[model samples]
Target: MDYAGLDYRNIRFPVDRPLTESERAARYKQESYSNASPMDFLSVIKLNSNSIDLVDRWYPIKGFNTWFGICVVLVSMGALAGIYSALFFSNRTAPIETVDWIGVSALTPLFLLLTLGGWWLIRTECGRFTHYPMRLSRKTRQVHFFRQNGTVLTVPWDSLFLTLGESKSPLSGTTYDLRAHVLDDDDETVRDSFSLGYPSPLGNAESIDKFWAFLQPYMEAEDGVEKTWHHLKENTGYLVPVDNRREGWRWSIARSFMLGAHWPYLQLLFSPFLGLNALGRMLAMSTSKIPQWPADVERESQPEVNDPYVLTWRDNGSLGWWELYWPLICTVVGVGAFVGVIAWVVSGLWR
Candidate 1:
């Protein structure tokens, strides 16, 4: 059969193109010789790949470290204070030497108690998360990441106007490698998969250009998918042929730093850190929903031409603060409070 015999030119979209028969015939020809793998249509897509809301992980280290660190130090100091009180208050006449040793002994148990309790809380919070998949769903403009309870988180993709793939995170200094694949209704073949480097410091520009690298073979295979993919990317403007090294809004950093990063939906709080995250989401929503303000990429940038396919990807690993983390935070705080109370009581007894 000739490359033009498939006659698949009926499809059209909001964009300005369609799949002609020649394209289908060529695709068929390649299929005849290709050893394509089974498609992995994700039952769920990772919602917030680039953002904190989409991926599940231990709380970002900075906040957790600082907060938890303070708790630990505070409790330790309390233990020491409590011991001192125990020693001096027992009889007010005990030798100073005896007093010192007794006081130190009192702290030993307190230290052990707080240490174990804090450890348990942190561990418990970090383990309960099992499913944390996210997807930008260019088609739906929705961000979906699963929660610890298996309830899916659905947020509008417009909530993040900037999501360029980055190999490096300013906070963790951890580099990320991202990949995407198109799934058939049955997920038979990864019709297309590649990377798009965003314009950022922690990003790899060379990697951004690589999207089309993996995509070209598929691009030549079908016209609609290429056009649709490009159109979507363009409209989102979060994506680019390569990462743009733009100094993203400073608010992005402040937001990323606070609330230990988002966990799906967040109710507002007075905390500026929390507010920062809200602001980031608001900015994203604004960019995506406001029609008057142009999308970073225009509809013209991504057009419809050949085949249209849905793609999904995973960070392929676990990460920061979440529902599981809350309990951990609470446990540490509880221990600190407990020790503070003990110290206060002992100080009074000694006096």
Candidate 2:
């Protein structure tokens, strides 16, 4: 089933049966790794003493790249149609042969496939919220997830069956996402399931474990958020502000390609693809609406006046000259390169 933008795949834990040996092994506790911090808290929207609001994990790169590929395919298809028109429909051209019809017949499926792909991408990516956010309210002892269909799923925090989830795709190998299963009245059947953070690559279990460890105390601790979890609160390095508003061009380029790569050489290495990726991401974001929490959720999650633990993207700090200028320069060069390459391809197809 598809929830938000993610497809639930390879759900190993049986919804109806008791946990098997392997499934039991995958189950982990909040106390699994003490003093651990979240690996993908980039989704964190608002963090305060009582609650933490987070956007659902989104695959910006994948969505942007897929849309880009579709654009190129559409352009190529247009060029092919033009070529066919010149050969068969123009009076100045030689008589169309039976072989030409056969060629068009053979290519029909490919054209249809490309059209279907473009349609599907547009259908999925457009007219949706930029993200689905979830709120973890320590005071309420409940979790509220914003569903894509405009419904909210509320469950008690302690009752959630938090476990390691594995999903495999040919493009991306076995990746892990932290998921919570909501049990039915029987307490064994999984009433529903949803992922918490972004998926991680294999061998990153330690980081995920620590993230879980960090969250447990943040909720369970009786002291003020500052007194008990000040250090953990400061760890908002992964927080990138792309969800609530239109991201700046430099940020789009920086976030779309070569994330966390500070070295100039690495930036230059990824520069060529950065421009188009930024454009793609921008296009996707423009079409999507920003998500908002329900009124009741807003009421519960609101922080106390003058609360010190409240955190936002501003805490991540401003970008440097090189960080800003280099991406802008690279984006210009990359867009020029992309145009040149597409021009060459279209010209060759025309001939």
Tens-place lDDT per residue, model 1, 251-272, is 2333233333343333122233
lDDT of 2 by residue, 134-234 (tens): 88898898999887666798999888888776655554565566778887777767757777765333225565575566466667766635533365345
By summed lDDT, the worst window of 10 consecutive residues in model 2 runs over 1-10
Off by over 4 Å in 2: 1-21, 35-41, 59-66, 90-93, 199-203, 227-229, 232-234, 242-246, 258-263
Quantify all predictions' global Cα lDDT against the true fold.
0.33, 0.64
Give candidate 2's TM-score. Answer: 0.83
Using all chains and alpha carbons, the TM-scores for the candidates as numbered come to: 0.26, 0.83
lDDT, candidate 1, at 7: 11
